[model samples]
Target chain A: MSTFGLWHYWVVIVLMMIGLYTVIARDNLVKKVMGLNLFQVSVIMFYVSMGKVEGGTAPIIPEQASGPVVYSNPLPHVLMLTAIVVGIATTAMALSLVVRIRETYGTTEEDEIRKLDRAEHE
Target chain B: MTFPIEAIVFLFLLATALAVTHLRDLFAAAMVFGVFSLLSAGLFTLMDAVDVAFTEAAVGAGISTVLILSTLALTDPREHQQPVRFAPVAVVLLVGAALVYGTLDMPYYGDPTAPIHKHVAPEYIEGAMTDFGIPNIVTNVLASYRGYDTLGETTVVLTATVGVMLLLGGLGGARHRGDAEVVEAAGDEEPTPMDRVQVARVSTTVLAPLIMLFGLYVQFHGDFGPGGGFQAGVIFASALILHGIVFGLSSLKRVVSPRFLEIGLAAGVLIYAGTGVASLFRDGTFLDYAVLDHHSAQHGRHLGILLVEAGVGITVTCAMVLIFFFFAGRRAAKSEEPGDRDRRVA
Candidate 1:
């Protein structure tokens, strides 16, 4: 764990790429969505992980006043909360779109849907 | 303390997501993505963003996955699709890379003693407590220091609502030629009445009201924990969506009317904008709510902020649900047609 600095950020970077790869390469629409979700989550982790204060405690105000309390910044957490909501809304919308796609194409395969779309366009 | 595992966890998450994306099998890929979302949420928790993580887990992993699956029902997984062109991708990558690299000179993450937290945030945290007697720091900052921003955020939701309504309400596209109807027309109608359109299960009906109550609690709970109008609005939307999902959209349509959603989005935004305008009447600065006569300057700040947040919550939640419905409505409308039954898929 002492070797956590450069390697940790690097790992997150790698994971983000993998998720992005899945989204790009996956032939399945569902899989593509999953990859996109992973990608979004990667960013969240990147932000949160960077928010650590060396000796920060929880961000709550305790009962005792005037006590010296070392705590992390609570703003990132708040920002993340909104992001999460946004993520959920995005998910719901994505799923709804997927459902529509499924209805039109009669299958969930990316290639087949594209082919059909092409045929329709042509 | 022992060595922190946050680094390792981050690495593992990154790996899982990469692996998930690389998988060939569509089903496995989606599941891996879900796990990736969960892991990232875990990372957020480690970083002290419990609320963000909670939402990531619930939405990123749960709702998003479900939606993707729904979309997959219409398309095939095996056919070879055209590759996305590389020119745009290259341009995007270059831009993104430049942006990330620019952050290198910035201070290290989580430096609580940085100029940002030190200069402005600490002042607000210390000031709000004595100023308004509220204990929550996030609430104070969001509502007071940046109350106007919160109002603007609410307006974004309202705008999204209008966008969604326009997207959903318009009757266009081969109006007489929706594919859903074509698929259904060929199939022999199945029994079980309303089973054609998949709805979320209703066994947990008892929990519906509780969820609404909890939404209120979360709205008010911003004074302490990681909550406020935004979280509360999402929670409220989730409850409404849950009802729509489980009981079927038809069931939900009866209670949460589309008209109501539209009106609520518009009204919520107007109220928020109106409040900021109202503050001007007190003969102070724009959003200079200090003179609004709430209690003291602190009280005015708190009250003004909360009201705006509430407006934001209302607009955002309504807008989100409406947007989802706009998309869902298409499928829902198709499903209503007897000929659209053939598209029932996962």
Candidate 2:
């Protein structure tokens, strides 16, 4: 349709929804972490898409140039580069927490862990 | 005669994300998630974010898959069947609708006149040659223009290492399986076909050092191309990880000691911040690269970016390696002695 540009964002939104749905609805902690990662990647995609220019090349300047060139916006790329690393750091931290939870409760399922906590309180 | 590869990649990304969420098999989901990461990296390349794509492929697709698989080894792989709850689904749909609405006013996919391109981006793009004299705009901006943010990100990597160490003790906790158990386990069962894949083992031995050499190249060549410390660090770590998996974690540890990695983890952040402090001593403000060299600002910027990026590469490599060790080590310790939580054998 005429709205092809907007369609990109709409698809990204759909991907984000899937991630959010998984995180909210899944009982498995590891699955939730997967959902979190999905969400982060989609968000990165959204930002990078904004930085795209129709006729632009990558942001690296050529050593030998024939004429002026169009480079896609580099700021978002820079920010998202750091974000990707941060996303992994967050994933590593969350997964380790999941491991600890499994150790303490003997199950990675949320409802089961909650039940154990509730029963322990009594 | 039009091939819409971008649209195809996006569709695959959606399908993979859906599969990751829908699958009850956690192992399969993690593997599919790796595919999803590669698809996303492909999309990043389509969007001209080759540097980001490089990082995503290395960190998101490669190291993330390895880490998740190691975690799955230590935990249950089957996600217990849960009745789908409509409440959360409804909530997610509502949030999605709001976000879609919010995008109604956002600039189109490749609108060159968008506000983002109008802002500081032009300055960075136009000034890349004159200001930093570096061909790679992202590296110049990431390592120089936004030095503080990267410094903070390095610290975050260190923080993740700290949190992991605290939650699951040091890599030293990963002691080798007892000699008797190893012999008995071998005697108990016929060897699987995977054990006989000497070709893969031989290939990995020949390839791992080459991968490290490539990582070093990416680390040093980032000033001119689509790679930097983050991608290179992961590449280096993955090489070691590959070696560990093929040869054995104990053998891996012998090659690169656990103590050395732990020190490298903190040392990366120290190197990063140390550069800024050194800049301050040179009569420059925090992270001001212009004052580092008395003769030329260009040389100073070059030196500063290189040093900070080196720090980033060191920290990220050690951090990824240590995280892998912790997860893989926990599995080893558990297999060694079931139900023994005290693995404080440093």
* TM-score of chain A for the candidates in order shown: 0.87, 0.96
What 10-residue stretch in candidate 1 chain B is worst by lDDT?
Answer: B182-191
Model 2: pairs clashing at backbone N, Cα or C within 3 Å: none
For residue B91, model 1's alpha carbon misses the true position, in angstroms, by: 11
Give lDDT tens digits, candidate 2, residues B90-148: 99889989998998998887888999999899899877889789999999999988999
Report model 1's TM-score to 2 decimal places.
0.77
Error of 1 at A78 (Å): 3.8
Instruction: Give lDDT: candidate 1, residue A26.
Output: 59
Give stretches of model 1 more than 4 Å off. A1-3, A22-34, A90-122, B1-5, B24-29, B74-109, B112-119, B172-202, B335-346
Give the DockQ (C-alpha) for candidate 1.
0.39
TM-score per model over all chains: 0.77, 0.93
Q: lDDT tens digits, residues A1-122, model 1? A: 33333344455555565556656665666666666766766666666655556566546566686867765666665555555665555555455455555665666677877898899998
